[model samples]
Target: MVTSEWTGPFDPSSDPEELTHLLSVLSSFLSYRRHAHYNGTHVRRQAFYSLPSSHWSLLSRPPFSVLDHLSHLDDLIDQHAELAEAIFRVGFAFLAPKLDSEWIGEVLGGDARVVVGDELKVYEKIMDRLGVKASKNDVDKARSCIHQFYREWSAEGAVERQKCFDPVIRALEEEFASRARCSPNLNLDRSEMSVLAPGAGLGRLVFDICRAGFTVEGNEISYHELMASSLVLNHTKTAGQYTIAPFALNGSNHLTREDQFRTYQVPDIHPATELASHTLNSRVPAEERMSMATGDFCVLYSQEDSKETFDAVTTVFFIDTAPNMIRYIEAVRNCLKPGGLWINLGPLLWHHAAKPPPSEEDKNKDKEDRTTDANERDIGIADPGSVELTNEEVVALVQHLGFAMEKHETGTFETGYISDPSSMLQSTYRPSFWIARKK
Candidate 1:
């Protein structure tokens, strides 16, 4: 089990900028309780009291009482808050090695204290605690991190993984196998085959690809995701070691209270054990088999050294995050070796698609939270103008960028993104699936 009781591998005297980023993530996890308390309990209780007496009387009668439901919801929120607190406790300890007393005093205030030994624990015993308060956006991202664990590391995610990751794995193996037979004197081995997965969330697909025997690197831009992924990939000791109620915060659209408070065991399989099994078969070290790159895909891979360095690139539900689709396409083209495979499966739900201006309240919050948002974006660069395109248009653009289409399937795979299985509301997408080779 991963807990505050377990010490992680930490490096002292790490980069200050990197520590700042990690602290921001830690603050978000720390703030989860307050965020959920207001949104899940206090606000609803206020609305319940604001209702007219006649309406209240009607709700007060029968087997179901509105007040009782509200109280029960508060209980659920408390449970969820406990889970968040546990995550924050361990996360702090995990990152404590890189932090010195001076740095802690500067960032977390002089009142903050660190206890090291079997467990590296932090205590904010004084009235003055952390110097910063996590913004609403940061808290929201932290909440999503819980749901992401279900999507990436739990048994519940197997259905989605089969629909999304399995095809990419099969294609990568088959394509290279075919190449081996077709070209004599051309050298290729699983150890030598380097694959890149941009926008890898929680490292599931990347881990799967590595288990398939190819050396893989996952690139991610979100710190919330990176922090959560680090916990699961690096700190976890066994499968089903942790349990969390991912759906507890959202009270509506549940068939029952149990459904709303459903629990799932994380990391259905221990990553280290599974990877070790692969290592036993291949006789290759895990470090050489998998890695992670942190930064914007375009900026990082556009460098001359990264050009034509990968044998294959896998992108799943990632391309839509791009502001300029052309920049993404160009980066992929430039990074793949001659005739290297490009596998993509996602809908073009452009993140920068036009939207209405923010309301006055939203603008006020933006003013207060802009610094947090800026820090999140500092590691990566983004262009302002978004070039939105249809599915056919994207395929044509891929071809224009010197990639020959090997396979293309449109609106065929029905998949869900971080969806709750038992909820009344379910959103599914018919993502475009295809493989192309750079000529």
Candidate 2:
């Protein structure tokens, strides 16, 4: 029942108008003192780079780039505001159906041009109710609620949720399509090779990979994600049967059998120290468990695996989340065959700074400092976006891992529908696609 109208024609393809709107909205949002505090402490700083106004007009000229620069500050603000509003609406619909229009408005009410700090406070409260906490009982409860909400949202088949990906996917396709095509060796056609997508949220990208002809095997950390992927794959597989090129594999390619797709159980660990131990014990032995272990891009290559087992490895939006980027990268490198390709999409740097000195309450006679740091705070800790590695540093890190960088490009969507745009933008999480082959 929420009502709002677009003041002008909304075009996802054009960048100038959108960029101007995006800046204006952002400025208004940041004008509030609370918003500035949150941005300084909780949000990443890279999220606020000012786009030149002339850049927007470049689209009308030659060599139209991916993102347009803004002319007016208000224009930029509008773009960001629109995206935030859409996310708030979709998230609310999925997670809080019982909330009436008035309650939703109350939660989201702010300057129409920008989100206020109050809005963020409301979001934090919702997250708390959803059970996003560190305690075992609390986390389990939160996971359950999240799973249920995702299921309900999927069932509703709301177009708004689907629309979110339009911008991101379009940008990705345009930026990476040519580079992905250049490497004929990486082109996966469905002769008989197996491809795996661990942490496959909703399986949207997996579906596209399957269409390119690789038999896909998917794993997820959440049961809800696994279920959603299964349902989508099932439908795609059935539909593909009647197509002109039955086995030719196009955009609709999927596993012919349910058993072909396997979901792995993500280990539950009380502390980071126990994560490695728990994973090792609960799953099959490291040597036999997987052809390759999928983690964040920086760490997708495992150091413990034999040299030539995996053909291809993929990671999406993982690098920013990894706690130990160096170790993780080493792990990924160790797992791959000499010539195997590592496909990565999303931000390279996940900003997180070391926590301040512990208060008296945190220091007890028996509590080990290592134990408290590793278990209590390390797993979910994120660096403020203000702290980040330069793009050069990120590139160097990849090269240091023994990968011959094959491709690198940036992608941005216009529709703001490709993934969680709010989280991506707020976190300064760029979609940086790369293909690296081991030497």
lDDT of each: 0.75, 0.38
Error of 1 at 212 (Å): 1.4
Candidate 2 global lDDT: 0.38
Superposed by TM-score, candidate 2 places the C-alpha of residue 18 at a distance from the truth, in angstroms, of 46
lDDT of 2 at 430: 43
Cα lDDT tens digits, model 2, 163-274, are: 3333333433433455457666875333233344444565544443443334443334332333333333322222212101111111122333111121111111111232
Provide the lowest-lDDT 10-residue window in model 1.
1-10
- Strongest candidate by TM-score: 1
What's model 1's lDDT at 356? Answer: 46
What TM-score, to 2 decimals, does candidate 1 have?
Answer: 0.81
In model 1, which regions exceed 4 Å deviation? 1-22, 52-62, 65-130, 183-188, 355-381
Model 1: per-residue lDDT, tens digit, 202-231? Answer: 889988988888888888877677666667
> What are the models' TM-scores?
0.81, 0.38
By lDDT, the best candidate is 1
